[model samples]
Every structure is written in structure tokens, then in C-alpha cells.
Target: MSDPSLVLHRIPETLVEALMMSLRKSKVEELQLRTSVLKPKSKVVVPSMRKLLTTEQSNKASKSVGRKLPVPSNQIRDIVQHHCSNKLTKGAVEAIEVSFEKFFKYLCRDVMAICLHAGKKIVTQADIELVMKRQRFIKDNKSLQILIEQNFPLEYRQLFIPVASSVTLKQRKKN
Candidate 1:
């Protein structure tokens, strides 16, 4: 009778031999397919690397050179009219748009800085809330701070609750 150990060792050897044979067979089949004279039903054409790069660069250049305001003027006008009792002139609307853009840009810079400082590549809601909280404390504009708090009160609560829970979990683990 064959020993159990011998049977186990022979089984693995057979498996390895079978695996090698299948690999060789597949490789030979691939080579034959490559060398065959039959043409593919459809031809694929790949653009040259340089041509692709140049086109991409030109597209980016055009986009950056002729960039429009982030928010449309008409939309800003609509928002202003919806909120304000008085109708603002076109120049006032334009000024609001410009100032809004500047403020938005500044906020984005702060959020990005916070994300980087936290050793995270993607900016999460938590990062934004942290920046907003800091900004709320620092800014003297009560109206703007109140507006932010009102608009995202629930979001801020949801983000912070999870963070507090995580801290408690870590403390428990330590204990």
C-alpha cells in the first residue's frame, strides 16, 4: 500500500505538472494567433503619444485662457432678487459675483490646506466643517457666520458626531 505522505506529495507534483502544461499550451496558442494571417474584423488605430499630449495641452490652455465666472450672472441675479426686498442693478450684481468668487476661492484654499495638514488626499466633509468652524470663530461678520451655521447645521452635527464616537472608541480600546 502507498504511504499517505507519498500520495500527498505525488498529488502536488501532478498538479504542478498539469499547471505548467496548461500554461505552455496557452502560450503556444497565443503565439499561433499572433502569427496567423487572418485579419481582425476591426482595426484599432492608436494616436501617437506626442499628438495626444499636444491636443490635451491645447485643450487645457484654451479652457484656462477663456474661463468664465464660476456662477452665472443671471443665477446670481435670481438669488439676490429672491433674498433681497430691493432690486439690485446689473453693476451691483456683477460686484456681488466678483466678491462671491473671491470668498469662495479663499475658502477653498483654506479647506485644501486643512486637508493637506491632516495627511489626507481627499477632502472630506469633516475637513470642510473644521475650516468653516475656524472661519466662523475668526470672522467678525455675524450675518455670514449665521448663514453658514443655518445652512449646514445638520451636516456639521452629523460629521462631528462620528468624529466624537471614533475618539471614544479609541479611548475604550486603550483602556
Candidate 2:
């Protein structure tokens, strides 16, 4: 058997060795963390104006930035042809696209305002219908009103129908 004094000395040495090993491990981990943090990040390269103007690059950039992309000119032309038996010029198609973007922005703003007034964060179809109703589009345009009534859901079409007052009903009954 080992002597008690030797055992006691060995005990302290083993404890010191364990403590040193733990300290070394912590130091190595800390150094690794420091090295990882100190590594240089790759620089972002801004594309040249010419590259940005390219269709493919612009589409990629627009998609990455979550911007509302303009409708393709061909699709716009197709829509114009569908509505009227007339072909639009290149400039006319561009003009229509710009006007559409402006109208959409204006409509979205009004819908968002309605959503906020209703204590909601997300825009809803009901909010858009409310905005359209408030804008008096259905009242002003008979054709558009008819189109909406025909295409839209029953709940949406009900918004445009005038309600008869109780007084009017009573007077009608008396008459």
C-alpha cells in the first residue's frame, strides 16, 4: 500500500493536472472563438450601372429586395388587346404599366389605412372592398359596378346594394 503522505501528495498533483487540462481546454476554445470572430467578412460588390440595367440582373435585384416588380410589357399588351381590338404602341404599353403601378400604390395605401382603422396589421380583401366602396367607383361607373356585382362574391356585391330605410318602408305600406 502507498504511504498516506504519498497518497496525499499524489492527490494534489492529480487535482493540479486536472485543473491545468481544463484551463488549457478553455483557453483553446477561447482562442478558436477569437479567431473565428477576427476572420474578415467578404466585401459586397456593387454592380455597375450597365449590369444593373440588364433585365436578368434587375429581376434578381428586385426579387431579392422584395420590391413590387413591374408587369411584363407583353402581358400588358395582351391585356390591351383583350379589352380592345387595337394594338398598343411600345410607348403606350409602357405608359399603361406606369399608370397601373401608380393606381396599385394608391389603392394599397387606402386599403392599408382601412386595415389600420380596423385595428389590424394585415390588409384584407374586405378592407379593399371597403376602400373601393368609399371611393364611389361603383356609384360613378355603371359598367364597372355591374362587372363587380357579376364577378365578385355575394358578400362583396351586397356592399353596393342600397338598403331601404324603416321610415320609407312604413310610408310605402301606408300608400
Candidate 1 — which pairs collide? none
Task: RMSD for all candidates, in order, please.
Answer: 24.8, 23.7
* lDDT for predicted candidate 2 compared with the true structure: 0.64
Candidate 1 TM-score over all chains jointly: 0.40
* lDDT string, candidate 2, 91-174, tens digits: 687567777778889887888888888899887666766787788765555545476545544443455444324434677899
Quote the lDDT for 24 in model 2.
67
TM-score per prediction, in order, is 0.40, 0.41
User: Each model's C-alpha lDDT?
Assistant: 0.66, 0.64
| RMSD to native, candidate 2 | 23.7
**Model 2 residue 129 distance off true place after TM-score fit, in angstroms:** 0.7
User: Where does candidate 2 stray beyond 4 Å?
Assistant: 1-72, 140-175
Q: Name the candidate that leads on lDDT.
A: 1
Window of ten residues with lowest summed lDDT in model 1? 44-53
Query: What shift in Å separates residue 30 of candidate 2 from its native position after superposition?
Result: 46
